[model samples]
Target: MNIIETNLNFGNLTKRSRTVRAILHHSAGSKASAEDIHRWHLANGWAGAGYHFLVRKDGSVYRLRPEWAVGAHASGSNSDSIGICFEGNFMTESMPTAQKQAGKELVAWVKKKYGFTKVQAHRDVQATGCPGTNFPFAEIANGSTGTVTPTPPTSGNTYTVQKGDTLTAIAKKYNTTVDALAKASGITDPNKIHVGQTIVIKGAAEKPKPTKPNGNTGTNPIIRDGQIHARNFAMPGLGADGIRGPRTKEAGIRVLQQAMNRDYGAGLALDGIWGRKSEKALGRHTVRRGEKQYMVTALQILLMLKGYYCNGVDGHFGAGCEKAVRQYQADHGLTVDGIAGYNTFKSLIQ
Candidate 1:
């Protein structure tokens, strides 16, 4: 969450009158630094580095434009929105964990500082598919992406560099590598550790996967009971054979249709078909935790189809359902708030 100041000067910049939301975007190309962006934007005959902040692939945040200045990133919303750009093209590439984590922290910090909750993709206000389809918008927007493991106690996990203690010796004592220690401690030179410098001693932690009902640790499978529940939603082609397969996965549409009919008073028949009626009936209802409704059932079914099981396809948004939703969101690059809303529904159903 550190914002690195830049010495690059811009020609002409206007101070913004208000700040509303954060508009997220990707550079649409790989390997560009803040200086590069500033030069490119200057070449575009405008202010330097149209974005307010540029987050690098190595989790470094650089201040591109002054926070109070209006940016030229977005179309018409530049006057009221702060633009934050990432350093990679998200359309064809997945974001690195460090970059994603840094983006999440930057977005959360900006939201807290500006007292705003609205986080929009570049395409949300423009006609282009910006920020890319592969960007983890949901996780970053909701600030739901987390560290793999809890940070250990400082006394146990950190070491104060003694006058005679070398990084190799400290790493050996901590059972880690010099490279990992250097990366964690932001040490540029392995041979450079002065006295009184405290270094964190930990390895890279991997994200934990949700445990399935069958005691597996990888992708959660759609249980036969989920298929059975889908069959109850009047899903055609399901023979109630207690077997989960492709047909069972497709039956999620029926679950959504049934939920809409029961919960939203949509007059469509529960034929388990995705059509105009189902699409139109899906209002802007964002379902989150602490709710007991048919929409939750639909969300559970959709998630289960995607190999993320939520304990059961029950109409409850409990911890399991939330976790499943977050995992699904992380996979699909959606907002990771564990809430099923218009975008989540569209991504699931469509």
Candidate 2:
């Protein structure tokens, strides 16, 4: 497998630290490569890249950290769990072919070496929509959400920009109008995006029904299973029914830690159970400014632009932003919704 891992050590972890389990999957929202993921960790003051290993869409694997070293990727579980970040946003889109191949191989090897019992997506632990929409959650989670298939994608689609890529060039290649591209990508300031920046691309008209599953629907709701199994030449069969079981729930809980971008499970404990802490992180807990630290990223930025504090775009959700959301809802007589619920989010979008 084409993978790279960093050797940096954090506070109490060292080469002696035994990796009990691994949490696999992608950078779901951004278009960053494995190398980019490594760089991002360094830029963010981490000891090094957070994941034990990261696979790029092109099939190149980079190791940001090793199993021996603790990762900062999954909030409360970082100390013990080794994290894996695959390139691409699988939540709302499909992943590259190469990435899918590498993911499986890596997982198999990890399972063999670590004797891991559970493997899953970020959303399995908590209530956040992460790992992206295109993730094959059932295959990875060991089951499906229900018998029902998910909603189909609409005609307008979004795409994140890649390195050495351009909007106009992509527009031309896709045979689409720049206006449609801009709107679909939700680029109010199209000119502001940078290398490795993602944008929406108007794809062929979406089908009326959910597309046939082809490895994108795994235990993680956002990150696809195809990429997760790409590590080895021989990918294991996940089974036909593809329904979620106990294993899938476990993965969601792990991902929940990352989705919430939590340092420690404030309202919850580190145990595998998904309860109040997960709910609060899912934006169900009470809101109070100067209490929550808002993490800055596209999601947080979008929330802030819509008048939520999001603590000045730092990429970590702080208490201030949570307070702002509650205050805004109360002022608007919108049920005093402390959480950034769908309705509140829609209002912010408006």
Candidate 3:
């Protein structure tokens, strides 16, 4: 649940708007990072990366655009919703387990923070197969509730090992003892199993009794040794699809204004409009070879926080700053372009 904050400065501040729903999108590309997506958006004449957050394949979360600023994601709904994009083309590949878990956790956090009651795929609002059909909507929706019903084990007698799996962990997941599992699998050493190795489990024909809704059947839900599953009680207004659309949008302009004033001391009036004074106070300038600005100072601070040594947090984007930016981008799997454009700015700020 570690969130890296990229303090991205949108040069031209769009009027603060309220968010009423959370939209899910797939990168539609393979193995790209948040910085890569940000660069692409900039090339398209966008302020920066459109999504408020980006979830990496390994379940790491990176903040792209701030929630208060209007995003450039969904065409007409950008002003009234938050966008979250996952890294991968779901049309041809299933979401990896880590990514799925991270996505669900992020969606749940957004719902709690913004009081958003609706969740939809990109195609649900527009006409495109962005978040492909292979996207597990049901599983993600169910995950938002903070509980998941474990699927019953298959009738097969053998299980293949996956990455990061071990005999002890697998045995615990299947509700069996490690010694028994090793004995059944004919392994001379319990720790000798390798990835993709098939291990046999005894009693392949025995099925655990089913549990009744009221717990009156005397049988409990099958529990894996170290896994926990809790029954999900239905909540009012949330349908079986786990969406409650058409909620009223709350006025959040004041929230944004207050935050700006406190953080940057933008000297803006309490008025919520994105007027000339407010825009000037929150103006963003590009940091390059000879540029100097308070925004660059902020970027330096963030870069240092991310463990990239930038020499000093001065208001200048010089050779040192450029070197730090390049290193950060490379470490995060972004293209090694050294200019502090939209993508670089977003990553540095976060």
TM-score (C-alpha) between model 1 and the true structure? 0.44
Show the lowest summed lDDT stretch of 10 residues, model 1: 147-156
Tens-digit lDDT track of model 1 for 81-146: 999999998999899998998899888867765679999999999999899999999999988443
Ranking by TM-score: 1, 3, 2
**lDDT by residue (tens digit), candidate 2, 278-346:** 556656422233343432232343343222343444544455555455545543446443455545543
Rank candidates, lDDT, best first: 1, 3, 2
Clashes of 2: 89
Candidate 3 lDDT by residue in tens digits, 1-350: 33444546555647445778888999999887878888888888898898888988876677887655788888988888889999999999899987898788778767656667788888988999978888887676546744321111122335777888898887765556778776555455788766645565432213332334663221111211001100111111221211111110001222233434655777656443546664465456345667676555555544543334455656687867766666566445454444555566544323
Superposed on all Cα atoms, the candidates' RMSDs to the truth, in angstroms, are: 17.1, 22.6, 21.7
**What lDDT score belongs to each candidate, Candidate 1 first?**
0.73, 0.48, 0.59
In terms of lDDT, the poorest run of 10 residues in model 3 is: 225-234
Q: Which stretches of candidate 3 lie over 4 Å from their true place?
A: 7-9, 145-350
Q: TM-score per candidate, in order?
A: 0.44, 0.37, 0.43
